[model samples]
Target chain A: MEKTIGNKTVNVSEDGYLIDLNEWDKDVATAIAQEEGITLADDHWKVIEYLQNQHKNDVPLTIRSVGKSGVVDIKGFYALFPEGPLKKASRISGIPKPVSCI
Target chain B: MTKNIVILGAGTAGTMMSNHLRRALDKDWKITIIDQRTEHHYQPGYLFVPFGVYGPEDIVKPIEKFIPDGVNLKLGAIDKIYPEKDKVVMVSGEEFDYDILIVATGTDIAPEETEGMMGPHWQKDVFDFYTLEGSSALAKKFRDWEGGKLVINIVEMPIKCPVAPLEFAFLANAFFEQKGMRDKVDIVFATPMSGAFTKPKATEKLDYLLNEKNIEIVPDFNVMAVDGEAKTIMDYGGKEVSYDVLVTVPTNKGSDLMERSRIGDELNYIPTDRATLQTKVKENIFAIGDATNIPASKAGSVAHFEGEVLLENVLNYIQGKDLKEGFDGHANCFIETGHGKALLIDFNYTHEPVSGTFPFPGVGPLNLLKESRMNHMGKMAFKWIYWNMLITGRHLPFVTTKMQEAGKNFD
Candidate 1:
């Protein structure tokens, strides 16, 4: 489905995740973060940028990788995004949610 | 003039390939499979050990017993593989030059990765069931345990048999109830994922099962360290969950041999072409099962499915023919929900497990993604099928390498 975020219509999944990374923008990320009761800051942007870069390169994102990415530590990432930081930050970054083998 | 085709790790994947290639290839090809261990364990049976459903003797057999008559089973630890020279060196200074190499050295639990996991309380109050030693130790622990705040934690993602932790919680729920100590036991499932499982539909179904069984769920809890003194596991996010007894599925990493050989990723898993099972190192080198970072479940069933694709691709590589992209990451596993019931889930890289009938479609004697006594029977019967048919390179009747989309409920 498509939704308007900051005067722009973007496609997203049923859970409000961006369907296309190409469709994602700073305004979209800020909007998604704001919906999660988070205010985008310099720290959050750094993490988001790290996640987006990894996604673009076809790398799977884990809390472990994010913690080890030299961008931020796990504790700091959690403090910035609060509960379920990995998923929350991922949605804001306009990437797919993390999944493991079933 | 016979060509050498060497296979490393005589576990499920390597053993199966040896049996497969031995039967398929002519007398012109010599197949040599290597392993440090002599015992070939029925790994899936490890889950049943702690519950007293399966004894150690039942799950283990001599590794050589599975090796067919024509294939040579070399028992030795692999030191390193010099892929450029097409040779493998042993720690004992043995060497084998090969025209083709197969890497089936699967993943193993690394409890040491987490701080204090191997500490004073290790295998005493804290346990891991991924190994025969740990499972047997836990069996003894559970035999006399009074039961209070039982915590089962999966430290990270991509562990072997991802559903095993959930099954442990479910079985524990039933185990205590059978012992008439259900009230005394408070079971909590702590995991890194945000739900009962990784997939949406399966997670919903399993989450319902957790609720029905009264098992508490603590989601998105990534372990940072274990405080043995406090009997608590603290996540990186500063969340703490205390436990009376903690059963953790530690971080799983591919064999250390991968790191030594410099042919693997950070986790020591070999990078392979997902569909072709061919490694990035060379055309003659291949990988299967948990050893390869192929985005498939690290379970026996996945290995079984990958075996078919690998066999074809290997033969093609030798004959100078175009390789087939036959592998679709098909994996089918029986999710044991305890108390004479289980759920059978069949899926692949593209498809998630859906509710439907299995092999027989609508007329299925087995169900998919739904619990049934019939499915439980199928799971139990799998033990015989594994030893007699699976590793022997015999195919299951009506089961295909690619997942069947028919009779499934997909929205």
Candidate 2:
């Protein structure tokens, strides 16, 4: 199923991948860890929120650099969001457009 | 048979020229663009990427997406340009012949041009926001960064978007504040210029902001080298400053094709007439944007305005008529100061950035020299305009090709 949140349209699938809103979900967050080949802890979410709020108005959020928020271990986060915060989240959130993920 | 118009480099200038000419020219002329990369990057987004404001995925799209139909997209590195024979050689062992050529080959960061800039600490401790990789790496560094002396240094002038370093400093202050490390971080602005910006009035206002943000400014400091192990940067005058992390804007150079073609100046920039953008070496060739050694800020707005003027001249050249010398180094940039506030500056070759309103003389929702939330929004809004209208060579409603002096205060 696809849902429109704000101006962004997200895709939700059965495997727990939210295509567009992956930045906001914990499962996509964990998937981000596996791609970057790292582990995410509960503390990493704080960094994610900080990054999301910091650039929310200017750009979209993704999985690529979600782990690099400075609050989390960057190498570890790199392991999680290897491709980036936006990409990982986009894959998990099932959002059609990446801009809404921000 | 259709005439071939070859454009070098698929960056902002080349892309704009391709779109503009595609619309203006008839089907008689086949416009072909050559670039090695497949993706078109929103170069301005590089600054925001480091602060986690723009993600890597958001700023990039396939080059083919913006390129209009009927334009031949050549995805290969350009080996050399044989102006004498009117041919461009690609690294893939292919040669393209053109009746008219547009040299939109843009500039790139040459950190290695400096003595020790690209040393062991690059991206780890020393970084630049000019490239996607550098900016994203610095974003990670900015996070968990407990804060110390965050030195923002500019090695030389004539860099793309002259005010970007200052923007980085301003945003860094905001970024640290959001992270609750504002008090711990000592942000410093070091430049080769005498002031915060190139223009005097804008410089005064920006210098004031530097002070307000508690960021120190070191002016006229020509960097000699970077001692990354010692965490210090030495200037030509023997001055030294140590930093926990160094965000440096290294020297920018034109495409290597310029050097290979033996047409570029000392910095690999093409020597061109400032007004007509015609290459000094070749009468049929023209240069725009950072590729030319023009006395203008290497910015997208300059290229945008130049595209309009150059199109007219290119058509004139094709018709064997006198070319129009119409380009006035018009450049307008949105200086992001973070915290939902930014400033707009508009100037040309003759005029400096003055205090006034933009698009309108007296009535403007966007203010110049003075910081405002509207200007910041305007900055954010430009990304869409760039993608949709500008690259497509569509005419913008408010902006024009020439610089307007009506509403600006000269004094």
Candidate 3:
């Protein structure tokens, strides 16, 4: 499936995650954040930015790593991404889903 | 030089192993995973089916969808495993040679093992949620249930998703309350265990949940049989618990092929080195998930954690290197306590679940052994993660293959 993020159309999986990493950008992320009902604050951006860096490097992004990244603690990360911290944060960061989350 | 790696049963453990090994091993290693089923059933979601919280569509997906690229998915029933030859034969008489074999056949519920459990009352008043069909039938039964005695029992231990029966009772309590029929339903939880759960600290919290919801816990009640005609479950001591609805978790056993191969123990589970997951019969053959006689919870999370350790050991075996004894039996579960609240517990072989903040000590967004709405949401969100992440062999960020005790409170 595909979702229109701003003026760009990006491929999304059945779960609404970015299928192609190349199609992701700030505009698409902003659009995804809006769709998820999260207003991307600076704290949210910290987690998102850290996730995007890790995704770019092809490293797995776990909640603990995000907490250890000095960007945010586990509680603050959850506060930034309410329901599913790793999932929601990864989605907003436009990365492939990390499997170890639960 | 091509080498073959054959994995039996492409369910939770099998699927994850395929993905993990595919990425970790060299291109010379050819991985083939075999399973009889085309569809992959998310076993944990079976608990919610009875309460209508999740439907059939929510829990199932194609096994091929999760099978990683560069891996072969062989769909067939196994005939036998010849450990001496390091080869597996299918029921169709086809044979495949392997340099290494991973038995991840997992376990199945055997309700027929108990007397009268699957009698005429089954799918009418008695049901088992461990299977898809039983769970679906219970859903319809719960829809029109006027409510009387609702008894949830465990016929035996070492069942898949061990906490599912308790989760059902908690959800039943919430389901009834949502329908305004809570007063009419008399919920009783019958278990062979001494408490509401196995772990002491976690059990303390779960006992409180059962008490707070007015659900009775009949612990140490060894079920002998079920009088289906009379709608009562009989214990060994001849005590009977009457029920309008009987939900049971039957005796779980490994594949019949395990017995056919003669490498299995009395219960048909392959005897394995607990730390290395290598079968006692053959160093070339290993077992993971519910297939091994490892003293680990038969939960998906355990399989995911085991996948990490197994991948490392498999590579070491291929390279003629020493296998690492790193598997700590790390297992964790999110317990649903109903009314939009849930509790999370993390533990391993040596550590019982304790009260503390998870991942980041004192900075947890999730509390251990404490009910919270976030935990419930995490439980719900797991279905998504199970499908997208875990099966794809993605390394979870902060979680380790072994249990960590830095933030845990034993005091």
Q: By the lDDT metric, which is better: model 1 or model 2? A: 1
* Each prediction's TM-score versus the true structure: 0.97, 0.79, 0.79
Tens-digit per-residue lDDT, B303-363, candidate 1:
9999999999999999999999999989898999989999989898888888999898798
Determine the backbone clash count of candidate 2.
32
**Cα error, candidate 3, residue B88 (Å):** 0.7
Give the worst 10-residue stretch by lDDT in candidate 1 chain B.
B192-201
lDDT of 3 by residue, B232-315 (tens): 888654568898988888878789999999987555778888799888889999999989877778899999999988999998
Model 2: interface root-mean-square deviation in Å:
17.6
CA shift of A100, model 1, Å: 3.9
Off by over 4 Å in 2: A1-102
RMSD in order of candidates: 1.5, 22.9, 20.8
Best by DockQ: 1
> Per-residue lDDT for A1-102 in model 2, tens only?
765433445565543445444434555555645554556565555555655564544333322234334565434543444423333434433343232110
Candidate 1 per-residue lDDT, tens place, A13-62, comes to 88878889999989989888888999999999999999999999877777
The local lDDT score (0 to 100) that residue A79 gets in candidate 3 is 69
Q: After superposition, how far is residue A98 of candidate 2 from its true place, in Å?
A: 46
